[model samples]
Target: MSIPHGAASAAARPDRVDPAVRRIGATLVVGALGVVFDTTVVSVALDDLAKAFDAPLATVQWVSTGYLLAVFVTIPLAVWAQARFGGRRLWIAALGGFLLGSVLSALAWNATSLIVFRVVQGLAGGIMMPLMATLLMQAARGSHPGRVMAIITVPTALGPILGPVLGGLVLHLADWRWMFFVNIPFCVVGGWLALRNLPDDRPEPGGPRGRLDVVGLLLLCPGVAALVYGLSRVEGGAGTTGAAVLVPLLGGLALVGGFTARSLTRPGGALIDLRLFRHRAVASSAALLFLGGIALYGPMMLLPLYFQQVRGEDALGAGLALIPQGVGALLARALAGRYMDRVGPRRVAVTAFALVAVATVPFAFVTAGTGGAVLMAALFVRGIALGAAMIAPMGAAYVGLRHQEIPDAGVITRVAQQIGGSVGIALLAVVLQHAAAGAHGPSALAGAFDRAFWWSAVLTALAVPLCLLLPGRPEPPPPARTTRTGEAVDPRRPTV
Candidate 1:
């Protein structure tokens, strides 16, 4: 259900992060960093994998593709897994799976083995990311969303900034295996924290477990994975019309359509409750995030390629140049969260999306000789818009949700953003391919990127109007307890 604007007056939502929030937030962030870094960090090592395995580029690409499919396919299982084993247990187990996969991947002797191991990593990672958000939000209990989100977003903001740099450095220094090796410390520490800090809430003291939603899983899992697989194929010379693209793309759609129909029939029992979308916040936020995935991911691809191809910078140089954007993203969180609580996500999302579109205009006008300082400043501003833009909708999605509802919300939003990302990358790849068809110079490549940036700006612009549909001000926190005699009573509940 949509949380009415009046539910949380200006007086209700706190602007500051609480001390308890800080403790859990820190722990969750630490555990989540491994997944974030591992995902982005591996992108820069694809070429190394191909060479090391003496395999075709397409074959080596599965190191990433297989992981992606596995992530999507396994994501649907998260709701069921969390409910069956409890969040704490599921989190620890997933982290353990990821850690084991990382170790096995680092030890693999062949590309096929590495690809198989990556699937394990993806399955674990897909669950962890959504579960991380769900656990943290439930802990927050609808207070200080801005502050809570700021801490949660650190990994995301840091990933783009550090992942490529870290990946490049690893390839230059040690070897590709270290990419997987680096995840060890994070997993070990995260697991330790889970064991120590997280509350254990086993279902009914190990009585009969929740019935598995077998039909929903069968429909939703492959359905989403198929869609992403289709998009991945769309980027190559095959194009959207080719059999390679159309078969899975259309087939995935049919399956998903069927899943939606099936979910409608299952109510609370569906793996992901489709009824949740009836709330304006969830549905609208999902839409904006869908577009956001395109705007953000599409431009992310263009930015690095732009610097390297147009400016003739090395990978390290491009990473360094993009540092300003990362800084902006990190800096925006504190302010964005505060304002989101104060003015509400609707207003903040509108302004932020517009700002993103405006900031992108400069990149859309780039030239071969464009000054680095000028472009850097624009990127910094764009990052600021992006940081706020991402947080507002994310916080809004959970505004009126009951505790149990958060798991489904998490899965829905993750799937939306993930599929949106795949769509963005595929579309931009096609556009870039066409624009560079006859181009032969740095100037020509710059033009191709300019066109792509325009597409990104248009995407952000498109999301602006939809901000109106986000949840209003977070419902004011519940008032303090009172006794029959009007004496104050503690509302404090047992730590869960």
Candidate 2:
């Protein structure tokens, strides 16, 4: 990440995101929209799906849980798969898999079939999530982490806000199948763009292709799935001591522990390379991402439920109520990226996270009679803070890494955030379940939501100090190298 002192500062290009970066960023975001929105959209339809399939609520929930477990199983394979097949090829392939799965899921005849197809989609999605970040970050090459991340995070910020709305509409009008149908355009357009735009960074002729880390994959993949399964049980409204919670949680922990030890014992380049944590920025970012996941996603569960159950809004109405938060996040990217480049992630993240804490307080004090306008205003501000909070730590993770190291960093950060979100949602679910148990009114439900918001605010506050560990400033670009000819040589690889 070293740069020549005389090179132009990154601030010079603050408003001028690289054209290639824009192209790559747009393509990745388009494809990821399906995955991101699919997650949130399908969530609103769980009850519909249960009734449609004539299944128990618990049985139908597996559609989401199975997909999540499938995702965890495939994430550890991204680094090896990309190195062997090249990022462009893998991107299109994964997108195609997701497309196929989407179509199959739409045609599913039963809950069991739907669950299986969703798992297929999840396997493809798991690869896409981490690979998307790796390809973009590696292409940007640490030159403009702030702007790069701002572009990378559009899907994340939008997914929570828009997914539910879209899902609500689908459930309201059409059947559950339309939820899967919506993804078709994003996948088709995304894959077509990748075929045209992405770089073909395959190994040089006769160059060695890396072997899969079979042992590491065996240990870590199942380990992640186990942990996710355990967490999903919590969302199923199981008590902390229930078998649903303990079996998977304990089993997942033991497997994860084994993976950690095995990853440590292996030399360099284990499946995920646990050694990345030794770097202060990388380690600290992972921790913050974990807590940040909880902060951003935990309340997502409570907010909609609160509106629907207490405020008497339908699913669509609840989704509409959350629009301000997404709008705020969408609006903050330019400023967040600019200030991050100017003042560093530490200052930006700490301020952004503090804003998250402040915004969350309004919810903690909500009453059955709270004004809708007041709550919406608070949500808008919360979205703005969350958007900035997410991007700052994300960009900081890659601040000092070499282009080759981006994939591993991508996997680490992606896993941390995913697991953290699961834990956050699960914790809040447990609290809400216990708080509302035997209660039977809007006021009682509002009380449960208030407690959950308090926990979310506390979790966010916990992440503020960790922001101090992020890298101070974006480093200058590496000194350019030229060929024997007078013309500047091509960069090692083109980004988009």
Candidate 3:
């Protein structure tokens, strides 16, 4: 096949991202923004939603909970769905589903209806999240993974920074429905971009397509959902001893265990390829990502609460206070990507995790009287380290993976990070509850938060050594070959 002039130029310039990869990454980011932003944006509006529908907080909480559960339930399906349909078709369809759900959610007459619509959103959003990474990685064809991942991660980095601020502004200035309305433009623009820029790579008719693994889906989907649900209940202060927490936790574990056994027995046909775990890059990246999730998310739960309960900030004020952390995260992206592409993921991840642990130490001593400037400085440092920590392992996960294997790797890494987040939030919530038991004043509550932050720092520190397990400095790509017509072409680049 003749190489396009743009492809030839990209092949010759090893440091520059391919024009095609950039286009795909940009398209995916536009679509992914709605999903990422929606997750955080709806969080700040729960109180308003409760009052708007005149429903109890517990029942209304399902608007978030249902969406989350639906997300988990459908996450395992991304690889299969992408295989069954082409990436381009799946992307547009999922974007449309999210848009439809967003509109319905805006018009929801009650909490139940809102929860249902949010689930619809979740089902689509879940597929898009992992598939976004899969499509980008596949298109990248193993070149400049660090740079590609940096682009892929933009929506995620921005979500925590912008979602809450936007949500707060919407609630203050307009009706709650505007929260869902905000998703419309992202979905519409993203879909249009996908149609225009994404390559149509659907499988040929009657080609060998992987069949849906019905039994695996039944076992894993509900299993992960149950696990996440149980952990969420813990975060809600239900305690670990309650039937509400124990039943789901145990059942989820058993189902997951069953899926694992079944997958091992039938590796080739399983919903996700268990054999990928044998690859050090994939295995180590998943492990580090799990811990990274804890480091990033556990502290996330505490930081906002610390601002609110100890510092007397309202929701908007708390969101505003977090801007420093978000800024640090944004700043870390380019530097982290550059270094990971240079010295490899190992050095970057280890240094990043160590920095994260060190930065978190300031929170361990937090008091109601702590200076805002001091706390913000610490958060800024932590955010930079956290951003680097996430980028390294994520990019490393695809190192040495084949084109067809990228989708399964995406699903694996994403699930690990998410489950880790749930575990971190649940564990920290329990620790805070116990530490703050019968706390009489802000000082005592601050003491309790200190203990929780200590735990967060300790967990983060544990991931540092694990970072060593990631692949070291990447080997340089072989020089491109020239066709008889003198056109440079990359042998490794897969045709989309």
Candidate 4:
């Protein structure tokens, strides 16, 4: 049995990534950092914002809640917007909107105003997140997906690491308003680079621009927002059966179910083509991403709280303690990207998920007196596995997708991960609360976190087998040919 030429070449040199792809990824990351960073940074500032406005914490919580709801509302619109407008135009427009929102938020006079302004930021950010991946993957033309995804995910990786630390620093030295003001540099630089680097891809004049499915939009936007809102309410210590949680959750599920039915019946004209679920890569990746979200975000809530409530660290100290996990995630990126491309997503995803579960086990046994070095070591390993776990599925979702299909896939995957995160946080929050009910000492609190961490570990482990459903080792690339000037050109590369 002879090895295929493409396979041999791929084996020989798996790290070949295009310079243009790198440029595009760099440009997108600059803008995306603001969105990702803002979400995490603001998370730490909600308390401060409440104090600044002399408002009740519940009222001020809307500043973050409103932003999240707005994001859900606009997420489904990205595919249509990018189709109606070019990617370049949409990128700049969204950046401009975020910049405006940031400015307004910084100047907000009250909680209500800040909430409204954050909604503006969310609307713009919702578009950029999916568009960033769609643009990069389309540019890569199905080649080097893992590497491209690594570049695409730079902001996500950095957000967890830097957002809180930056937030803590800002609050220590400045006012809460500076949190929004800090977004100015990212927006300005991102907008400028986007103009220069991104290709103008507006739909051709008189081309068949599909009509926006207003019905589908109406069903999905509010459905997703309601779902997220309900879950967030749960995170705020409300029970699942509470009116605030159940009303929105059931309503959201009903609306989303309606959208799903409508989309399945009218795939061609729907806001998001539900038919993409037919693809094995898309379907499996979506399922795994849901689990990955729980594994990632559920513990995220517990880690900081464990540090604060059980270990007696302040906000800044808690944030600083998480630095090791971030460092591990960073270190895993390059290696994970390379191997995901070379060996494929399935093996990597399974191995990574298993490792994540294993790493999480130490936390399940956490005690008030657990050594800091030991816990940090566990977090570092968990971070590495989590990073690879995310990169694998994200890159896999795009496998075998066409240029036009990329945006829809992007939207589906993003929504899945996000909703999954909401679910994770809510469920974990409930668990922690129930386990710690009436607890007074740090020792008792540590035991409650242990139970919650156990749930996180079990949830993560469930995905290990599901990862087998992901696409196996990538097929060999098509052969490269030399141009007239002897420049090697990949025949598979997209000219668009």
Point out the higher-scoring one by TM-score: 1 or 4. 4
On residues 1-496, what C-alpha lDDT tens digit does candidate 3 reach at each position? 1222267777677898888788889999999999999988888899999999999999988998999999999889999888888888999999999999999999999999999999999999998999999888877778888888899888877786668878888998899999999999999999999988887878788788879999999999999999999999999979999999999999999999999999988948799887899999999999998998898778888887888899898878888898898889989999999899999999999999999999999999988999999999998998899889989999999998877889999999999999998999999999999999999788999999999999999999999889999999898987888889997767786554
Candidate 2: Cα lDDT at 112: 98
lDDT for each residue of candidate 1 in 37-94, tens digit (9 for 90 to 100) = 8877877788788889999988888888889898998887888898888888889999
Q: In terms of TM-score, which candidate is strongest? A: 3
lDDT of every predicted structure (CA atoms): 0.82, 0.86, 0.90, 0.88
Model 3: lDDT to the true structure: 0.90
Best-to-worst ranking by lDDT: 3, 4, 2, 1
- Per-model TM-score on C-alpha atoms: 0.93, 0.95, 0.97, 0.95
Off by over 4 Å in 2: 1-15, 489-496
Clashes of each: 3, 0, 0, 0
lDDT of 2 by residue, 1-496 (tens): 2121222322345346667667888999999999989877888898999999999989989898888898889888899999888888899999999999999999999999999999999999999998998888776656668888999899988998889999988888998899999999999999999877777777666877788888788878888898888888888877778998889888888888888998878887678888878888899899989998999888999999999999999999999999999999999998898888878899999999999999999999988999999999999999999999999989888876767778999999999999999999999998888888887889888888888889889988999888888888655554555556643322433433
lDDT of 4 by residue, 1-496 (tens): 1111242243235468766667778999999999998888888888888888999999999988899899899999999999888788999999999999999999999999999999999999999999999988876768888888889878877686678888888888898889889999999999999887777777778777878999999999999999999999999978889999999999999999999999999838789998999999999999999998898888888898899999999888888888888888888888899999999999999999999999999998988999999999998998899889889999999888876789999999999998998899999999999999998899999999999999999999999889999999998877677668865555665444
> Which pairs of residues collide in candidate 1?
8-475, 8-476, 146-337
**Model 4: residue 388 alpha-carbon error in angstroms:** 0.4
Total backbone collisions, model 4 = 0
Candidate 1 Cα outliers beyond 4 Å, as residue runs: 1-15, 206-208, 482-496
